[model samples]
Target: MRPREASALDALPALPRDDDGPVFAEPWQASAFAMTLALSERGVFSWAEWVDTFSGELKRAAEAGTPDDGSRYYHHWLAALERLIAEKGLADPAILVDARDAWDRAAKATPHGKPIGLSPDDLARIRDAG
Candidate 1:
């Protein structure tokens, strides 16, 4: 693993990994992981803060009756990343909500097996390049 990823994993001991590196079951999971690492590297939030927020998310999920069977690790990860982004004012929380809603609308509009395409206006509302 690269030095940064190694350091990230060191700080995130809960992360699932193997001999190669962190294991992600989905592409979006990897995106969420990378985005968190990038944000931390840029000093948007300290890794300690990330850990605390992520731990809180996991705790919340468990309290809500979700089991920590590793199936939803990335779900908590993404939730934590979203909370941090909103807490830091990097992006408006409403924009994220709107984006999610827009994606749902677009997906419902799209036919089966084809790509889900959002409207230009919805796409324009996206602030992050990622």
Candidate 2:
């Protein structure tokens, strides 16, 4: 993943899962979906355009013989997000740098050695803070 895209993922909170369920649950996907929504709301790209680009990327990847694996799907999503940011020149490298630094600081500061994972509520707070 690109540095900024990785930073964005790192900024998100961990997804809670049910005890008797698959590892990936609604919460995890929702976290990713929320990131997409937040980025769109910030004018990085329109929702329709973002969906189109990501869908196209997935199709291209499948055509290129990459299996439809979970990792590959997430990678494609990250790549698409990176491309969108680059195409619009919406998120500055400096801004990403700051985010990266803040993420590092937050990770270090979190209690119980938990990485800085934001809940949906936390995301809302961050959005409002900005």
Candidate 3:
């Protein structure tokens, strides 16, 4: 791993890590983890900012009676990322919402076990909405 990535993981004590690296239960979890580190390295937010947002997400999920299973951990991470991005004015919240809807549509349309690629119309719709 790159030094920056190593430092990022080192800073994230709550995250599960081993000699191999941070362990992720699923592909999307890994994507979310990488996105947060990349954004922090770009100076979009501090690692502390991520931790603060993520902690709040975890707390809220717990209060809402969500199970504390490892399965839903990354779901909370993604929520925190979205919240932080919007709160920091890094991206328009509406754009995120539109992109999410577009991706959901694309995923549902794609076949099981096949890669989901967004169609031109999906891109156009998000762009138009923005």
> Who wins the lDDT comparison?
1
Model 2: lDDT of residue 4: 55
Error of 2 at 39 (Å): 4.7
lDDT-sorted candidate list, best first: 1, 3, 2
How many clashes in candidate 2?
A: 2
By TM-score: ranked, best first: 1, 3, 2
- What is the model-wide C-alpha lDDT for candidate 3? 0.86
Candidate 2 residue lDDT tens string, 1-130? 5565456778865664445655444555656667888988987678999989899889989898886655456678877776777777866656566566666666766897565764555456445544
TM-score of each: 0.69, 0.49, 0.68
Off by over 4 Å in 2: 1-28, 38-44, 63-65, 113-130
- How many residue pairs collide in each prediction? 0, 2, 0
- The 0-to-1 C-alpha lDDT of every candidate, in the order given, reads 0.87, 0.70, 0.86
lDDT of 1 at 124: 76
Which pairs clash inside model 2? 13-117, 13-118
The C-alpha local distance difference test score for the whole of candidate 2 amounts to: 0.70
